[model samples]
Target: MQVVIEKRGASLKVKDGQLIIKHGDQVQALAFNTIDSIVLSKATVLTAEVVAQAVEHQIDLLFVARGGKPFARLWSPYFGSIATIRRHQLLFSRSPEAVAWMKNVLTRKMENQQALLYALAMPNHATDKIIESAVLKIEEDKQRLQQIEGAKLADLSPRLRAVEGQATRRYFQAVNIHLPEMYRFGQRSRRPALDMTNAMLNYAYGMLYGRMESALIKAGLDPMIGFMHREEYNRPVLTYDCIELFRTWADWVVFDLCRQQVIFREFFEVEAGGYWLAHPAKRILIQHLTDFFEDQIEWEGLTRSRYTHMSLFAQRLAALLKEYKTDKNKK
Candidate 1:
């Protein structure tokens, strides 16, 4: 289970194989063995001992802002699998295969989006027409991806981005049509999140990004060196690159929550210029996403938890990079 510390000004430390959390008049101790990931959000004071213990226990420590976006992550520097994969990842970032990698990830994203929208449209003809139109648009993007085989990296990059952008727009439009007027949104908004549904998506994706970082690090890939995303100041580039494959999954989660009436209009606090989840509402959503990440999904021939799916995907990415380097050198 994910251990989330959301109390304002709370202090978290480690002692004698236990995680100790203190706030005002309350104190709690958690056994390290029971924890998989620790999330520290906004004004939470995390001690250095906790960092060492987390590394020792192979636990992921993530720092998220008040807006729920993960800005940084900490994990054991020691390699769990192949150490050379990190070195190979850097080389892959400079090759044409980088474009290839991004294209594959984006293709999966669009496919997932299409599947999700189409499935939602089923059993309810109200959304069928709009959603199917977007699904057809995604098919065109997939065909465009195939045409980029011999294109220059500079040329292919924008084309891929355009396809992804257009597909996302169409998808959002299709899904919004089913929502009631008060629950509808214009488009995807970030950071401050001008609308409620976008808020849910950004928050869920933020939490998922932290998990992806943990998985990438466990697979011996440096999160800073990535193929599709730019290595901006302190950005986790590899996490961003890998997240493209899972964005639709997050979107589906939000859709499910709405369908189940888990997140409703009354839950959002209207303040200033936009809508935001208050502390209590956020805690509820956090629990929801935690369960979502652990939920089982069919991968290939077998069923596995979503977390395991991401871990295996990262492990395979490492192996693919290693093999790509070997074949290139042989030529």
Candidate 2:
């Protein structure tokens, strides 16, 4: 599983080949094999031995700032799969197969959104109309997505984004209906979230992004080389592409927290810039999100944890890309 070191002044060390974490009076030791990743979110001390052992055992070290945004990641340079996978990945970005993959990913995302709305809809309620309308809009966009013909992502990017953008607006419009008035938002905001809901959602999405990037890297895929997303300097565009499939997962977790009223204004710190989650709010979001990801769900006709589903998809995509005989590499 994942070990989150979020407590201020926490420190990690290696003792007898086991991972030792100490914060205040609490101390815990974890076996190296049992730990998948370590997320450092607050002031934490670690020795060189700890980093070496983590890399030796293939454990990832992800660092995040106060707003839950991942700023850096550490892993062994020798961990990526054979260079053949990445060779094909670059060619795959412009191929017809890439177009198909993009369409499939987006449609699946829209399908998940509709499923969420359907699950939330109930009988004899004014909100049912709102939810139903949102589902219809998303479905219409999904149909439009399927009808679009393109040889490559360039041919499809703009129209695809338009449909996805419209559908997302409708989806969030319905989602905001469920939020308490104090937490409801007019639009999605980032950088500095203007409302409590936006702040929580942004933080949760950031956490998801870090996990998804780690998964892609472990599968021997290059997170910077994207199929549908535009390439930019020093950006993990592939993570952005793959994250579409799982955004709803983060949305579900945050929505549940909001509905439960477990989050309050006091949990947030309002700044001249906007709003940020206090340390307590961050802890609550992390706990709930970690638990939600570990919960088993029906995926690909089998029961698997949501975290496993992402890793499996990354591995499968890497395998599939390796099999493709790109035009440049063809005999």
Query: Which candidate leads in TM-score?
Result: 2
| Winning candidate number (lDDT) | 2
TM-score of 1: 0.90
What RMSD does each model have against the real structure?
2.5, 1.4
Candidate 2 global lDDT: 0.90
- On the 0 to 100 scale, the lDDT of residue 207 in model 2 is 90
The models' CA-based lDDT, in order, is: 0.79, 0.90
Q: Record all residue pairs in model 2 with backbone atoms less than 3 Å apart, i.e. clashing.
A: none
TM-score of each: 0.90, 0.96
User: Could you tell me the lDDT of residue 150 within candidate 1?
Assistant: 38
Clash pairs, model 1 backbone:
none
Per-structure clash totals for the candidates? 0, 0
Kindly list the per-residue Cα lDDT of model 1 for residues 211-292, writing each as its tens digit: 8888888887888886656536567888888988987777777777766666666777776766777776687788777788
